[model samples]
Target: MPLYRSWQTSHAHIAIWEITETEDFFAASLGFGSDKKHPKRRLEHLSGRFLLQYLVPGFPFDKIQISPLGKPQLADQSLHFSISHSYPYAAVIVSRQQEVGIDIQVYQDKILRLQSKFLSAAEQLICANDMQRITLTWCAKEALFKYYGLGAVDFKEDMPMGSLQRTTPEDALIDMRLEKTRETCQLSGLIQEKFALSYI
Candidate 1:
């Protein structure tokens, strides 16, 4: 599989790859061996390497650790990051001096099945126009969860996403805008009939 990588912002970098072939190459790119150990530990190791290569210098790959919730952290507490992956892609977002999280999902029918679990009643009412709205709602909520560093929180109860107005790519120069009772975040992406890609 080929890998596509780019810098989203000066302090933020994104690594996106289509994982159609195998996880071996992905693992190697993250500097992991095939040996089976602790999955969480291995993820931290990989996350560490990516951070050092792009953020720090002379840091040992194994020197980082992950929280029980699967968030990566430096054993020495120097950097912060989050990792996410979907069926065919994996992305890691890293920041040199701030907390960051990233999430990727392959838009699919499965999201519809869990709509009630994630979307707020207000969101549902606003998105009633089309089924695709449901997918975007889910993606937005998921991205919010990652941004807050709370994975899979009660999307309906914990982090309710308010109504969003879809802005043309040219109108706002951004993709989706998510609002909450207290804060707002921008999600950039495109939605097709089958799937969507969003970055927060």
Candidate 2:
């Protein structure tokens, strides 16, 4: 199976799929009807849909709609789900209990150059290593953005990092806050060999 990892709780579940199959495989397996000009994007979309069904058996994959903010939602709001992809992997988080978000990013050195765009000066000082810190912050903000399910969010100004603790070489726990909504939550992260995964 392509499922790289999965986490389950009483209210929510997260599944990550490693997209090693060809685009034709997904198109045929999931009945992907929409034609995406880019092969990678098409694979991501279909893989996300496939992971969604795996999480919720018999989910109406064809009835999903996009919100004004670009969030994909079920037509009847029967369930809430979020999908994210970064190159070779696609992640899906589903919940029948509450809102959810998930993000997976392949680690790259370029994130250091783009740190200021999404992280504040104060937040930048919290991490010991530039690459790992930046990747975690980016993943955290991305997950937060999905949880908010709204666009027009300023990553540096709106989402702030409260606390960052590295428990192991491949795992970290983060406390994040949204300034506009006054909401706060903890996000768990896994620093894999090739990519980093964060979800809440």
Candidate 3:
């Protein structure tokens, strides 16, 4: 089990798993009831469950359901959780205290082409022509979208990437706004050697 890194608070815990095992490995151990046809997707789903269980011992995994808005929630909303994956990696965040969101993305230059779709002109200016910065900005907004826990979000308009400051060589502190809900969150992001992870 390649557990990459984890963060924890008094009521919340987030974990990431580097997927190196075969789908069969997770299938045997997880035995998830939903069988995804795509092999890669199946692996991601199983790994997410495994990580979720790891973060919160005895979480009611069987009670999980997707809301009409496409956010995963407990049948009774007893526990707040979120999940995300980028090929070969899966992430989960669980909170007994508050709703949560987490996202992990494998670093790729291709994101630049889609920046215009999710980022405004001002947002782009703040990124300042750096792919790493651009990638982290995108991840921050994605985390915010997940944090919002509802569908039909306009990335560029609904979630705006605010000012960014480099705290270290490979970490950044980001400010983001949820325009629709008029809420703000400060998120910390990590630029791993192969991927980027963000949460709030």
Candidate 4:
């Protein structure tokens, strides 16, 4: 049970798992199939479901449906939830009372190359070319996008990353915006040894 971390927000249950199980283990226990082309992706899909059930006991898996916006949701929106995975890490946020979003990303240098695609010039300056900062910023916006649960959002323009404040070495908060709905809020983030996690 490599349940890396699990916590609760005011309205949601959140968890991040360091995938240490064999693919067969999850595949058999989950009994869920995946069409992901990569082996790691298949493992991630199964493990994500595992965490969803872990966080929300008796979660209605059968009611899951893809919205026109491409969000995986329930027909009645009974429980708003979101999921994200980064290789050996899988994260999920589930709340019966409100919508939720969560994202996890491993520290990777590739974020530098793609920063221009998702970060405004000002956001780039905020990141200051630091790898972890850049990765966390990207991760924050991703969480915002999932929170929106709508299609066709511009990462750099529609969802922007704002100032970051770290209260402790392992905990942080990011000021973020969702332009489509003109939303401004603080997104919670976690700084870990190998990955960054964010949610809203």
**Cα lDDT listed for each candidate:** 0.56, 0.85, 0.83, 0.87
Highest-lDDT candidate: 4
* Top-TM-score candidate index: 4
Question: Rank by lDDT, descending?
Answer: 4, 2, 3, 1
Q: Is candidate 3 or candidate 4 better by lDDT?
A: 4
Worst 10 residues of 4 by lDDT: 26-35
List TM-score per model, in order. 0.68, 0.94, 0.93, 0.95
Clashes of each: 0, 0, 0, 0
1 against 3, candidate with superior TM-score:
3
**Residue 97 lDDT in model 4?**
92
TM match of model 1 to true structure? 0.68
TM-score of 2: 0.94
Clashing residue pairs found in predicted model 4:
none
Per-residue lDDT tens digits of candidate 2, residues 107-150? 88888888888888888888654677678778988998998887
lDDT of 4: 0.87
User: Weakest 10 consecutive residues, lDDT, candidate 3?
Assistant: 26-35
Off by over 4 Å in 4: none
Instruction: Residues 11-80, candidate 1: write the lDDT tens digits.
Output: 5655554445434543666656535386644444444344345444454567667667765578765666
List the candidates ranked by TM-score, beginning with the highest.
4, 2, 3, 1
Per-residue lDDT of 67 in model 4: 85
State which candidate, 1 or 4, has the greater TM-score. 4
- Candidate RMSDs in Å, in order, are 4.9, 1.4, 1.5, 1.3
